[model samples]
Target: MRNNGSDVLLTAIAPIVWGSTYIVTTQFLPDFSPISVAMLRALPAGLLLLLIVRQLPRGIWWLRTFVLGALNISIFLSMLFVAAYRLPGGVAGTVAAVQPLFAVFLARLLLSSPIRPLSIVAALVGIAGVALLVLTPRAALDPIGIAAGLAGAASMAVGNILTRKWQPPVSLLTFTAWQLTAGGVLLVPVVLAFAPHLPAPTAVNLAGLAWLGLIGAALTYVLWFRGIAKLDSSVVSPLLFISPLTAVILGWTFLGQTLSPIQLAGVGFVIGSIWLSQRPAR
Candidate 1:
């Protein structure tokens, strides 16, 4: 029971940590390029963790690591950065929050998890809430940003399913280290090819990068995997619904962004959906 309590606490915190990424990226990181930021976040943190772990995965685990790395870290973060850059933070965040829906659908198809009716309804409600929050006439409607956010969510969903399917023998830290390393390696060429010249890193940017690499990617994954290991996906995944709300609040507080009445209503819907999704089936 104590272990369960710890897992729940950790799971709840992971998304809140992730929610800060938007503010960090927009305010701190250099305006060099999204891919560059993504690479830096992954590479250094990956190397640090790998050095600490020092035990490499073997056999089929290598392939699994690569696939998970691509889906979870590389593709997901890269596209998320792009969406954040192109779209309003609220829009990007709200779109990314659709991850729960994607996760539910993929879990059904891949993990053979039961797709409860309430889960589907909750997902749709959440989606509608996000749409209300983000769709504004003043904000530039970039199809590319929308596409990137959805793709990132899809990648995350696939990665979540894969994490369940391919349970590595290593500790959560070790597994996360390998995945980060693989993702960083995959991103290197892309970053080099696209963003060879980086912007001068300011103190603020460096601080943001450090927080992102260390806390957001590294510590968050450690906690996330630990929670997933201890809890059922049904219990663990819905906790992610808190992420966008955190983003919204953070955006409002730190970034001085204001939420419209409709957007506030949207947030209520999202919270309601998340709560509903977490309840045990009747």
Candidate 2:
């Protein structure tokens, strides 16, 4: 029970780290194109991790690496950056908060896990909370951003399902490194073709890049896979709700973004939903 508690706590930390991503991206990264920023985030970190692990994928795992890498890192981050660029930060985050809902459905379909009605309810409530917090009548709703966010969510859902389905023989660190490297390699052509001009890199930008590479990508993924290995996907995925809520708080406090009453209520709903979702079902 104590170990379970610790694992949950560790699992919780991954989202908290992720929640800061928006604030960091907005404040620190150069106003480069989203794909450029995404590539920068993935490539160096992936190389660093690969160097440390120094393990090559064998047999069918090579395909698994590419597929999971695309779903988890390359496609998900690219879509997320598109959403972030096109929509309000809060709205983009709200869309991302629906990840657990997608995860639940995917797990049921892919892993043959039974979906508890309570899990669905919790996901809906959490998503409602996100909507309340992020949506506004005055905000310009971009179809592209909406699609990007939903696509990002779905991509991540597929990646999580794949993680459950394919257990690599490598250590958690090695597996994560391989996936990141693969994802980064996939981004090169896209970056060259679309984002030809790189933004002027600053010390702050460098610092932000380092943080995302080391803490966000490498360490966070290590914790994520560790939790997935130990816990049910149904149990592990919903904990992601903490991310957007944390992002909201960070945005309010650090970014000087004011939260409307509706947003506050949404935050409350997200918090409550996460709490409910994390509870062990009867």
Candidate 3:
């Protein structure tokens, strides 16, 4: 069993790595369709992990793996891409930001995690912070996009809860591999149906894909699933704040983005919210 501090840190690494996706997508992968990019990232990573672990799901594990894969990866990612395409980046981000709260609700209902008043307040504050931090004044709401974004959040939240509910019989490595493969395979038809013509691949594109697959998806997810197994869903949930926080930092450092006063305050609020959510119930 991992120590609490180590589990927290390991769980954190997943979102931090995910936060770099914006930079990687912008800098390394340009002009690629979102679905195609997702397919590349997921399928290759899943295959790579399968090769390394060499364990296939058996009996009921197959169904559970596919369900987890669809919820966590295929369906969640599909809706996310839809929201990103239909809505402004800021609007989509704000909508997706409510995921931690959803996780909290699911945890309380399903995992029986204590529903602390402070955690609820923290989630609300975190949502407000994300809105201020990411939502621009000109951002307009598209109902379909908004729905997709919320659904995406809910999908992941439920996935997190279900993962906790269903313990894996195999090692985390093999279990993680199974979900990734199942999810990636499920996404294949979606990619074929929606995005048939992929962009021409370059050396840089391949390199970026490799980085996203190997490091971002494979390794980070291993850490993430293990954390889910060991930690409370609510505890693991709030750590997602690290993703946007890291994104804000990357934007400032690498892209010369500046934070407004409101955004700076939002950052503080988000940090505080994450801290509050992780605290033991009083």
Top-TM-score structure, candidate number: 2
Model 3 ranges with Cα > 4 A deviation: 1-3, 84-91, 138-144
Candidate 1: misplaced stretches above 4 Å? 1-5
Which should have the higher TM-score, number 1 or number 3?
Answer: 1
Q: Write the per-residue lDDT of candidate 1 for residues 129-227, one digit (tens) a residue.
A: 877776778777689998998999889888988798777798999999998899999999998898899888888888999998999988998888777
The parts of candidate 2 lying over 4 Å away from their true place are 1-3
Put the candidates in lDDT order, highest first: 2, 1, 3
lDDT per residue, candidate 2, 1-282, as tens digits? 012778878988988888888788877874878888778888888889889878899999999999999999999989988887787777788888788999888888998888888889889998899788767786668899989989999999899898978887989999889888999899999999999888778899999889888898899998998888888777788788888788778878987878888888987898788777777766
Candidate 3, which ten residues in sequence have the lowest lDDT sum? 84-93
**What is the number of residue pairs that collide in model 1?**
0
- If scored against the real structure, what TM-score would every candidate get? 0.93, 0.95, 0.92
Clashing pairs in 2: none
lDDT of each: 0.83, 0.85, 0.81
Ranking by TM-score: 2, 1, 3
Candidate 3: clashing residue pairs, number: 0
For model 1, the local distance difference test gives: 0.83
